[model samples]
Target chain A: MTTLALPTTEEEIWRYSRIDELDLGAYSPQRCATQVVGDPAILVKSSGSNVLKHDDVFTQTNRDNSEAIVIRVPKSHAGGAVEIIHHFDTSGALYCPRVIIEAAENSEVSVVERFVSADGVKALVIPVLEVHAAQAARVSYLAVNELGATTWMIAHQEAEGERDSNLNLSVVALGGDYARVRTECRLIGQGASAQQVALYFADGTQMHDFRTTQEHVAPRTHSDLLFKGAVAGKSKSVYTGLIKIHPHARGSEAYQTNRNLTLSEGAWAESVPNLDIETNEVKCSHASTVGPIDDDQRFYLESRGIEPATAERLVVLGFFNEVLERLPNKVLATELYDRVVAKLAASETVGSE
Target chain B: MSVLEIRNLRASVAGKEILTGMNLTVRSGEVHAIMGPNGAGKSTFSAVLMGKRGYEVTSGSVELDGVDLLAMPTWQRAVAGLHLVMQYPTEVPGVHVDELIEQAWRTRGRSTTELADAVVAEAERINFDARLVQRAVNVDLSGGEKKRNETMQLALLKPKFAILDELDSGLDVDALRDCARRVEDATNEDSLGAIVVTHYARLLEDLKPDFVHILVKGRIVESGGPELADRLEADGYAAFSG
Candidate 1:
């Protein structure tokens, strides 16, 4: 096996990241079974991830020593929903869990992946998920990160859409000391489309980072992204996204937006949005904003006899409602909404001061 | 009976004084109309009374039932039975009208279940579009719909004093009459006092007022019965300007 060096903050892709603080020596790879709850016939032990590239040290490491599983939906079949839960309980351990979802031609499927850890456990979790949508297929994937306060997670999610295929990707991150997700979605066929949404809240020294790319490589492809987050206490967050339309991808449309709310004096947020269009007939737009709760919105609610804290909570919830409506599954959307409310209630005292 | 007394109310915006010793007293079940020209401190007065930020009360006292109103925050003032129907009601996205009203009603120690029924009943009484309650508050609504939304809140919340600030600015003849009639019904049924701020006598025709006051240079320059509004309507504020 070849020894590869870990990535540092000096790399352009790792800019504004806390990668330099990671210590590879403190962790050793451990094996754990990922619980898959769904149609048993759909699960198959796969050799490795075929949809993702091993261009980075993390991906290579995961490929080197991970038990890969694939959930395959038969052609023209509708796989209602599947649940995959990963639980970490060992301290000072490294976990590399790989999952690949395959939707055959004209098939439809939905999956919910959750990562959780036992309280007070300190570990590093590197999770990789790949989605392959064939022609005229539809796929929806949702990821929920609920690791322990001391745990660290670096997740990679990649998806490819074929002709007339549709993909919906969503994430709700509310845990881990430092959680980062890198998402790359490519529309490689004509008339393909992708929609991405994320909601994250960080408090009590937590940090959440997101990097995304929406690449349109075929004619008449479309992609839209919306990521909203809030930082309270002494926590922080970062969101950087890019919309890239290839030269041959004429008649493509893409939009990227990232909005953040700084809820406390000590909390902070950073947002950067970029667009690269090499084609003439393509339409693209990118927008980002980092600020505090809108005073007018707060006043509007408070003036109606709602208390200050309750008003703040309501405004924050309202801010996330747009994203919530687009979530693919109704049951999980309701659960995530309640989690947001609980998170706001937990940080109310920190925010008020 | 409830009383809203504004005594020697002095306020400023960005260090520039707008209200110079303004005084007014409103009692329950009474309607007072304040007519003024543009930039005569009409909106500033409402902002100061509602404790909206950025309006500094340099020296003044607003008393509600002999209790200091300036000391409480805006929500507490709402709980103390003070409401303002804004000239341009703000649009709150992703927050439904019924959701906001229900939560606001519950905050005042009222039953949540009853609020839903009351909202439906109030919307019907005012001829308000019942469908709007399910949509975001004032989002994508026309100017007349916004005014009707505010009037619906006024009738349901039932505050002791309701300040109708430019309530007729964007209303048509029919919409103006509907909103004004709702306010009149509130005053008669709930004994709600009101301070109507407008530039013309059109709204006064639908909602009759017991007194009419001409505001100039931040103070009441003339006060009389409803005849003052009719006379001012025939003529302009040339005689009232200092």
Candidate 2:
């Protein structure tokens, strides 16, 4: 086995990241395990990740140290939210967990993988998830990151949807010192559709970074990506995404939008959206916006008797309402809304002084 | 005792003077019609009273119930019982009308569920379709529908003072009458003091305003009873021009 060097911010994919701050020598690899809570038949040993290939140093390291967990959803299973809760507690530890989800043809399934950590513990978690949606299948997957304040997470999610399948992917990031998720999705079959929605907020000295790619490889595919975030108290967030339509992917439709809100003077956000369309019959568009909330929107609510502070809180939460509504589960969305409100309330007290 | 007073109001926008020493007083349970031609600063007067930014008040005083309104922030003014029914009601995506009005009552510590029911009942009063309550605030609504939604808020909040700026511009005959009836109903139910700005007397007919002031060049050039509206309707704003 060859020793892989740590990555730096000089690479295009790692630009503007906190890669330099990461010290690989500080952590030793640990074997991770998973326990199935739902149908035992769904849990099986897999040889490797077919969808998520090792593309970066972190992924390669994860592959080198992690034990694999495979979830197999049979045809017509009609599953609910199957949860895989992974908690890290060891300090000065490096833990890698690999997961693969295969939704059989004509099946409908939803999975939620939540990552957590012991409070104030310094640790690193590198997780990789691969999802393969078979023909005519429907899959919904959510990754919720609620790590400890001193912990860091470097994760990758790769998915492929086959002929006429439907894929719904979501991410809700609210905690961590430095967290990053690189999502890559490909529509490899005709008439397939994918919807990606994410809501990430960072407070204190935390940083959240996201990179995504929506690739349409077949004709008449559709994809919509919306990622919204808020940063306060010297925190930062970055969003970079691409919408690519191949030459043979005629009559395809793709849209990518990334919106960020900077709540404090020290808070910062960067948004970059790109499109590469080789077919004239394809429809692709991308938009990115990063700034403070609009004054007019706030004033409009205030004039209607909403207190300025409450009005701002409403706008920030409301900014995520569209994406929240698009979530596969409304109950989960409501819970997330309340969490965001709590974060805003805490920030309110910070600003009052 | 309850009145909205604007005295010697001189204001400007972007260094160009608009309101030149305007003056008016709206008492509770009274409706005032402000008739003016284009460039007469009717909208500017509404904006200034609402404490909208971009309008510099050179010399003026706005008082609500003897409290100096100009001294408070825009939202504090709302909390103090002032509201504006903007001509072009702003659209706030992702904010539902029912939810926003619920938040309105929430700030006042009112029961939001009760206020929500009140919104639906108020919608019925204006013949507004209840389905629209679920839609985002003012988004994709017709001009007249937007006016009706505004009236619903007015009824719900029951502000001590309200200003309707060009709410009758894009309404049809029925819509105009409906808007007028809604305003009249709110005044009867809550004694809502109101300032209605318009360029036509058609809306004033249904309103039967207690007072009519012809504002030209940012000043009240003419003030009279309901008959003033008829007179202006017969002789256009030509007599008040310049």
Candidate 3:
């Protein structure tokens, strides 16, 4: 294997990000030979034994050498959820994993992937996932990142939708030293639709960054994006999204929203939503808000005999509930709700202590 | 015995005094309606009882069945049998109506099996579809449906003392009639006491309260039997406000 060098600030995507702070020289790539162990409920495994591929596009600019792990779902297969679990336990190292999902025509599937790191390990991980939805197909994907506090993570997700196909993607980030996620969806076929939802919570000294793009290249397509996040302690987060409608993509409807709740004065959040519509008869709107919890709303809950801490928890959960309710799967929605509530509870406990 | 007693209660929000030395007493097995004009501190009174934040209780002593109600948290008050049917109940999205009611029921120490049975029975009484049980609480529900949902919550919680704040405001005629009957049935079945706050007598026509008190400018201006509702309906709150 040849050593690949990481990119610097000169690259357009790497600009405005602190990519040079990461030292990948001492980190070595190792195959994930160890079998995964955890509660099956939270783990996601591939359907068949397939040779997985790993690539680092930032280090190796050669797209030819980049390998892609493909998981195909047949059109006749019944639609259900698939879970993918990635566990990293290495110390003082960098890890990169690439994944690809292909949904056949008229099929429907949901994939949930979890990224976790062992305790006491200091590592950097950059993961890239690609998804292709064939004509009239439907695909829903969720990524949950829960790494150790000493770990740094940067992930990218690119999806392409075909004629009359639907794609829904969600990301939940709860742990990391400095985590950044970039997700893009391209509607390449007429009548295709895409929905994107993201929920993130950062506390202590954590920093989370998110950037997304919804590109409409065909006519009569639709897209909706909602990204909500909360910050506490001395944490910081940033969200930047773009909705681009091409000249030929007339009659496209697109909406983007980013809302942030700051729980502590020391915490900070920044949101930027942009739209570029080149054609007539296109409807596009973007909204971004960053503020603390509404005092009146919190008071209303507390007055109902809910304690201050519990009231805050309920309000925060209610804030995210608007987005979570949009998820199609009730069971998965409940599970995600529980996980977010647990995060809030842990923070409340720590704040109180 | 006195289920709730409020003495010289004075509360404020954002440094503005709203509840000015108000006083009230509610006994078990009795229904008291607090009628007032808009901004007479009726809603503020309910907020104060729920221990809502931001409303500073400048001076007051609230006791519930010999226990200090003011000292307990809001949920604790619910556990202690204090329920409030808010005028505008918050839409708790992503939470199923059944799940929320069940959680509230279990929080009151009811067994899971009992809670489930109670929810089903209450839903049936309100003519609520079994399918609505799985839907998010109050989200995208019609005004009438939201009111029924509130009543459903009241039935499930079975609070010993409840305060309904203008529950009839957004209800239609049929919904009002149904809600009134449900209230009558709930009170009769559990011998529960309640403070029914409203501006009109239509809701009280069927559920004839044991007493009706006219609340004016944060004070009870007049207290009488069911006839008071009829009188207020004819005369209106104008004369009472003066």
Candidate 4:
């Protein structure tokens, strides 16, 4: 069994990441249960065995070791939440799952992938996913991390949209010891649009890292990305994204925004956004902010009779409302908000030792 | 009993003295109009009363119905029935106006369903656009609408003692009249004690304040009836501060 070398933090693509700390030799590959909690018939269709091109260690390792599940949505099947929960119970082992979702032409679908583990289960999970949105199809996928504190995950997602297609990708990162996800989105057809939104919160020495790319390959394509995270309890978060417009992709519009809130003085977050435009006819902009929650908003809420602790929680939840409102699944958004509020209550006291 | 009483109040911010030995008293079912010139510490007094940070109450005793108010946190003060219609309402981007009021009343043990009803009913009674309650708290609201929203909140919460710190500053004639009527109705219903802080006499005239005080240099230099505000409308704070 040949193993790929682990990425080091010195690598620019993995800069400020915990990749160097991962010891691939410590664990061996194992297959986790990928149960379709919903009707499998609606999601178990195949779009043929389309190969994904990627050399990343986690992606290759998953492809070689894990079973691949290709979920197919029939043409014009507009309403299906294809919810899949990956359960990993093996301790001191490596679990990997690969999911491939193909939305047929003019079909709308929502694929929810959640990673879960029991408490005290120590493992490393690597998942690779590919999403193909066909012409005029609409697809929304959400990945939620609910791993235990003893686990870690490094995942990658590659998504491409066809002509006039729409794709929305969202993430809620609230668990695991150290989790990193790289999302790459390509608008492969003219009039295609894609939105990438994520909400991540790290506490109690946990870490979350994200790398995203928005590639506009066709003219008149548009992409918008918003990622928000909060860190507390000496935890850390890193976000680096790129919006790339090809030379012939004229009249393309891309906007990227990343905002982070540091609830404790010890907590830290870093945001870096880049734009690579080869044509002057493109409209592209990126904005990034990493700071503590505004005292004005806090005081305003406090003055309105909300307890300080409760006020902080509400503000933190409200901070993510902009992104949550974009979710196609309202029930998932509300449940995710409750989970975030619980995470915030743990670190509500900003200065308390 | 005094609904609110500030005894020998002295406060400061950033090492600068603002409220120096100020004293005031209010009882339920009474409206006290406080007229002060610019730099007279009107806003600071409101901040201090609300327990807003950075305003150090150097030496003072604030009692809300005999409860030691200074010891409570800002939110607790509101829960204890002390409300302020801020001059400049803070803009909370993602919090809707209805959510703001509903959350505040929630702290007072009000059920969400009850408070939601109150928010809608009170907004209607104040003639506030029901659509405004759907918007973010004070974000992109017109000045008049903001004041009306605060008045709408005042009606919903129905605090025991309310402070209108220049609530009339940004309102037009009709907005001023509308807000005044809402405040008046809330006071009559709750038997609320209120302190109207302003630089102009228009709001006081609309509300028909029972007692008017000319506050100069952080101290109440004179206290009388509606006639006092009428006189100050003509004389200005220069008559008392000088």
Candidate 5:
């Protein structure tokens, strides 16, 4: 049997990534239980066949050792949000959690997947999530990453929208020593639309990397993406996104925006946005920014009698508020906001010392 | 009464001297109008007083209530009762005015209930849109709305001294009168000392300054009663220019 080789940073897709530092030999396959909560009919442990593509070695490996779960929203049913929580407690373990969500025609559903690990655990987790929105259906998925400080996560997310369907994908990642997620959204049917929003914050030497693609394959399709992040301490973050319109996808519209704030001299952030159009009569734009907090914003809060550190905390929270406001779930948004605040408060303590 | 005194205040920006030996004194409940031509250090004076970065005060003494105002940080200066109504208030997206003011007030041990009441009261007093306090601070506010928002903040913060830097620059006839009236009421009711900086006589018609000083080449070259504003408005700053 031939050995499978891991990907390297030399590839364009992995540019500026920390994949070279990963050690696959140190980890062994282990099991982490998946707890399904809310709307029991919508989520189940099943042996459902996977329909999404295995684009890379990570997805293929996850499929080989998958703890698969299927979430199906019934036809014409409108239900509240369901949650899937995966808790990892073993040390030096490799765990792969796979999820497949399908919304029937005219159905509406929301799902939140949370990955959490025990403190001080050293492990590697690969999570694969596939979302399929049927004709005229609505699906909203939020993935929250709260892994341990010593854990590493490589996540793959694939979403597809059918005729007249709507899809929303949101990510709030503030955990793991090194976490990377690659999200791809495809609009395959006419009048299908998708919106993706994310808020990621890194501190205390942590790193978060995101790569996203918005592909329009049919006429009159639309997609919008907004991702914002903040880096403090010696932490770092990287975001690269692309908008692609196919040859026959005329009258398509796509917008991508990524903004980052580097809160410390040692922290770093990089944003790269690109657009490709194979057809005319399409509107597409991409914008990205990586910089320190605005001095004017800092002064504005400080002049209002807010202490410098407190002023910074407020500004950072305000920076993330844009994403929070756009979140589809208010309860989840509040929880995500609290996590960001905790991270900022932790970094503030480190800064004052 | 509290006093904000600037003695021989010489300041510079980008290594070039702007305010060369400027002096002024404003007491609580008193109004002082500072008129100057373009580049005569009108805005620089306000910036330096608020401890804004990049504005260097070479050799001068500024005392707020007999304390070394220059020795404190910008926020500390605000806590010590000094505020500048910025000419162009910064646009802070995603932060609401109510949240900002509430945070500022709560940090000083004030209750949120008081802030809520004060926000509504002040907004009404200044004819500001009460709903705007719920929106992002100055994000999409028009020029007139921005000035009104600043005026509302001035009333709520209640600083011991404020420098209205070109408060009338962007206001229409109606907005200018309304803002001037609100400020005048603040001065009379709260004893809020102010330094009204303007180039036109229209705003002074309602502000009614106690002293009008002509600032030329950084220093107050001439000082007189309210009539001085009329003379400068009629004769322009060309009389005092080099």
Candidate 6:
């Protein structure tokens, strides 16, 4: 089996990212042996017909890859959140684990995938998720990346939306050494819709980069993307999104928006939104904004007797709530909100000094 | 007896003074109306009372039952029994109206079951459709709908001291009357007082206030009984300015 070489800075995708800081030579790809410990509330196994058994994409990719894990969700199950915890205890190398989710027609499901390492373990992890939303199905996906401070992570999500299906994906990044995420979704059938939302907070010289694409190839399709993030402590984030509407995809509506809040003078954010629309009847727009939090909104919350820290948390939560609340599951929405708040609180405590 | 007392309260925004030495006393069970021309600092007074940031408090003090209001943050002030129905209520997109109202209620120490029941009953009293509770706060709402939503919040919160900043603006006559009636019904003899800020005197016709003060150039230029609204309607701010 041929091993896949780690990407270098010379690659276009890794240009602005700090890929050189990752020393893969010192580590070897090893399967996680630690007993994953977390409540079902925080982690759970997926239940459904194992679609990965018949056509496992990760099996084919893992021959030379270092990480491989399979998750299967069958059709027509009452949608609920499934949490998977990836624990890295010892310092070593890890390959991308493939997660596969299949939603049947009229079924609804939500999953929260969390990547966390053992305290102080300097590790490398690569994770990939593939989601298939069947015709008329609904799926909500959330990923929380909270690896060890010294660890490096590379993640990707590839999704396909079927006819009249609905797909929603959200990512929250709060830890890692150098993290990169590539998310892509294709609307392959008429009346399918996809929504992408992400929130990332980086600090302590860490770097986060995200690349996303929403390709609309079917007529009457819809897609919307909203990713908001904050950077502090000299950390940096780069977000690039593309919305493609094919020539025959008339009557389609698509929008892409990226908003970043920089809290420190040295913190930086780069946003690039691209649109390729070939149909005149389609309604499409892309917008990106990178700046500090709205002083007015912050002050408004503060004036309500909320302390500065509490006010900032509320504002940040509110900022992301614009997307979080859109999730179909109230329980999942509240859970995500609380987790994001906890992350913000943790950062504030660390930065207080 | 006085729930809120404002003495010589002066404020500014972007270096321009808006409220200059404004003095007012609101006792429990009293409804006061501050009617004035455009740019008379009516909204500015409400903003300052709520501790809206960026509005520099140059001088004077505002007290809620003798607690220095300027020292309190907006949410604390809210928790201290102060609620403001903004002239232009801001939209909190993707936030359900019920969730916000419930949060405010819970923050004020109401039990979850009690809050839910109270919210549902109050929402019904204001003729709010049950479906609206699930919608984003003030998103895609009409002028009258926004005003009613503010009243819904006031009913749910039931604060001791309330400020209605231009709450009568942009309402049709029926909606205006409905809003005024709701305000009258909501404010009672129980340690509850309100300061209604508006430019139109017609709103006061249905729910007569105990006192009327004409504000001009950041100061109370005229003070009188409910008749002051009628007098101003005939002569306008011309009689009170300067």
Models 1 onward score TM values of 0.96, 0.95, 0.85, 0.90, 0.96, 0.81
Pairs of colliding residues, candidate 1: none
Better of 2 and 3 by lDDT: 2
Candidate 6, position A56, lDDT? 26
By lDDT, the best candidate is: 1
lDDT of 5 by residue, A1-353 (tens): 11467889888678888999988778888887778888877776776645565467788778888878888888998975688899988888999999888898999999889999966888899999998888999999999989887789999999899999999999998888899999989999999999999999988889999999999999999999999998999999999998999998999999999999998999999999988899999999888899988988888888888888878777788899999999988988998888888888888889778
Kindly provide the TM-score of model 4 when superposed on the true structure, using C-alpha atoms. 0.90
Note the DockQ of each predicted structure: 0.72, 0.70, 0.25, 0.59, 0.74, 0.27
- Classified by CAPRI criteria, candidate 2 counts as medium
Q: How far does residue A295 in candidate 2 sit from its true spot (Å)? A: 1.4
Evaluated at residue A220, the lDDT of candidate 2 is 96
Better of 1 and 2 by lDDT: 1
Task: Candidate 5: list runs displaced more than 4 Å.
Answer: A1-4, A44-54, B107-109
Model 1 lDDT per residue over B124-199, tens place: 8888888899988888999999999999998888899999999998888888999999999889999999999998
lDDT of 1 at A285: 85
lDDT of 4 by residue, A57-148 (tens): 78878877877777787899878677889998888889888888888999888889999997688899989889999999998999999998
Top candidate when judged by DockQ against the true structure = 5
Instruction: Give the alpha carbon lDDT tens digit for every residue of A84-156 in model 2.
Output: 8887888898989888888889888788788888679788999998899999889899888888889999999
- For model 5, the TM-score of its B chain against the native B chain is 0.97
* Candidate 6 CAPRI category: acceptable
* Candidate 4 lDDT, B96-189, residue by residue in tens: 7777777776788887777667777877887788888987788888899888888888887778899999988878899999899888876787
Q: Is candidate 2 or candidate 3 better by TM-score?
A: 2
True contacts kept of 6: 0.34
lDDT for every model?
0.89, 0.86, 0.78, 0.86, 0.88, 0.76
TM-score of chain A of each: 0.97, 0.96, 0.87, 0.95, 0.96, 0.83
Fnat values, candidates in order:
0.59, 0.61, 0.32, 0.63, 0.66, 0.34
Greater lDDT among 3 and 5 belongs to: 5
Off by over 4 Å in 2: A1-4, A33-36, B109-113, B169-173, B230-238
